[model samples]
Target: MTVHLFLGPTLAAAEAAAVLDAVILPPAAHGDVYRAAQRGATVIGIVDGYFEVMPAVWHKEILWAMREGVHVLGSASMGALRAVELAPFGMEGVGAVFEAYQRAELADDDEVAVAHAPAAYGYRPLSVAMVNIRATLAAAEERGVIRPATRVAMLRIAKQLFYPDRSYPRLLSEASATGLDAGELSALKDFLPEGQIDQKRADALAMLRVIEARLSAGLAPKQVRYHFEATIFWDSLRQDAAPLAEPGEGSWMQSALLDEARLHPVAYPLARKGALTRLLSRALSDEHTPRPLDDETDAAILSFRRARGLLHAEAMEGWLRANGLGAEEFARLMESEAQVAAVQRWAAPHISSHVVDQLRLDDLYVRLWARAREKQRLLEEAGLADPDLAAAPLSREELLAWYAERRGEGAAPRDLSEAALQAGFRDEPMFVRALLREYHYVRLCEPRER
Candidate 1:
């Protein structure tokens, strides 16, 4: 519903008023047209001559608008060229304002012509009529009122006559009356057919060829080919097809294509295999990664875990299984562990020592599993039975009970508590054990008489 008007340097006050909501003024000294399109306006208008001669800025804006489904209209200067070039994409270009005005004279119906006027030229019949045919066709096309062939014919005439060499007054008069600018001739060479094929048809074919080349070059089928063609069609007509709610919202699949491109080779079977692998991998993965809950969400999740007696390692593992957190689900949650941890820390600023102890136990359990796996591999290589070493594994509860009993009897230093031992194990367990064995090897504790 947003119409963006593009105001040329010579845009009149009345013309500006006609398309106030639909207009986009030309970029300021340091501005960009594409950036303007990103702001959500839907139509752009450029004066006829400006687009043809100074095509740099005009072409960029025109191209951008077409790609983004924003409509572009041109009259007077650049209008003619744009009408011809952009017709395939649905842009409308009028020949001259004077031509529409002349049609007003011949018909002797000022009201019809006035209604037909482009809101820029008032009481100037020639200028009004010049742009009238193009504007009429534009409106008809937009409204689906005229047949496609009828619209094409009107556009063809505008394309042939509304150019630099033609007389503005005569062309406008002829176009207004006949809806064709047939007689105003300067250099007929400029209007001559470019080749055997119609220029517009040829341009469209050329774009298709470019798209095919990109596809053949291994550019993603979704991004460089499909979306590119879709963008062209949308841009040609200057229409916003849909809204992008966020940076990667509508583009996730397209953006994923880049990941596929990176992982796959550009050549043959390997490329095919890699793509298939990636696709299957994604398909097999969980739908959403677990994110660390935000402060409130984390608190909720942690409270749930605690209420269910799932805070410790063994309990958490059982909880995960009972809740159906399999490999795929676990993979997702693991991806968000750091975030979850941050959220938990932020939410529970005054967590009890019991909760802290459970967390440490959970961490140590993971470390123990890793160490067991590593040690098992070493033992297997050394021709030893790894199962024997793995048997009778120390449980967190048992380790804590052993530490508590020793501490109660004053038989171990405070630093030798379970938490300290776990920390020491993580930091330098082999060194600590070597020092212990040197001091206490073969030492015996005497049994006290009951």
Candidate 2:
């Protein structure tokens, strides 16, 4: 029952860990929930997240996690924002910030946003969130430190300022600039040092306490009412968040291999057809009769291997390596040959040039099928793939030169831009980024053959 928490800024990692035992992560982003679910976390708490500098966590990823039976909890910072949007879908929301969002009292995302330090510095906050300022002003009015009208005036000023610039000093300065009386200003300033409310931090702490209580009582996995639909975009995010395949293999190895096949005319059509056929077989499999394994499994497997020219022990081993399988894994597949054969038979009709041509005519089908094929092939090659061997970063100039000379030393491109376009990139910069990523991936691969 491991619990994972993505937190930053609102509460320090040490403070969060003190409230609830959890694997504390920096902040939620893109695939954080998906990856946490993959890691077998039963509960997930999102406290903060990345937005301005990079992509924020996707809503579908949360839905996907809930579908997988992970109890997702949200409050404070990004959590509160996501909770408001997803509460109807089963994400549990905690604290005032979440309530405000749910009631549409705080419609803007910036109400909870704050400038914070880098992860290396423990994500120290540099500026206050608007929600905190609003809470502080409300508290001040309640405490009789300021008039209700003065509090309202101060709130308006705070709201007008950017979230990152909404510090106590700045808020007070703005209040003075807006004709706040000297007596009231003095009262507000004196009260602020110890009386200012940290709404985000309070909400974060409250959420953690809730988590702690639930854990102590042994809470069950959450069940959402809505079905999670895997959109292409969702699928892409999942792939990006997916754990490395086998040791020494990264998630992109299959795509890279497909890219390799795409460059060759003989393999391109075949890869496309194979990809489409595989998808078709998977979609239609539910209608087929059950094909349980029995005594004849081993013999049937041997015959199948022999038919594919894997007749000798060495040939069989080579096939296993290329397909990223261990002997034990190959044996398991052999035991389930009937099921495999059924799918293969069902897919046979779709593995033709005519069908592939029709699929290609539909651009979406072509792209999806290509991605599907890449995934399938990479899954097969995961055991043999070595990510560590290719983990070095390549410079833009180096990548351009490498692309130009990939075929042969003298076959360089007319220019960097030409080379990039020829390599299927939208532009030179995009191409350079891809090349660097690929170079790094390849460097991470293991040196020894599988």
Best lDDT goes to which candidate?
2
Q: How high a TM-score does candidate 1 get?
A: 0.22
RMSD of each: 31.9, 24.5
Worst 10 residues of 2 by lDDT: 383-392
lDDT of 2 at 166: 62
Model 2 agreement with the true structure over 1-450: per-residue lDDT tens digits:
899999887999989878788899878877888999999899999989877445789899899899988999899989998988898899999999999988888898888877654444465676788888889889989999999899888888888985645678878887887789879889989998899899888999999898888889988878778877778888789779876565345669878987899899899998787667555555555677355344334334445543465433335444666787765566556545545455554444555566567677876676867765654455346532323223434444566567556656653342354344334455666666565544443443435334
Per-structure clash totals for the candidates: 38, 20
Residue 54 CA error for candidate 1 (Å)? 5.3
Q: Write the per-residue lDDT of candidate 1 for residues 1-450, one digit (tens) a residue.
A: 444443332344354554343443431111234545677655444441221112234344556556666655544333434444555556555433323433443222211111111112211112222234445455545554445565565455555552211223434444456643333222222332221112221222232243334335654211111123335644543443233343232467657766776666665456676556445434433342244434333333333443354433234434555554543454344334334334333333344455557657668757755755654564456444222212324433444444456458432222232223333332234434433332222121122212
Lowest summed lDDT window (length 10), candidate 1: 110-119
Best by TM-score: 2
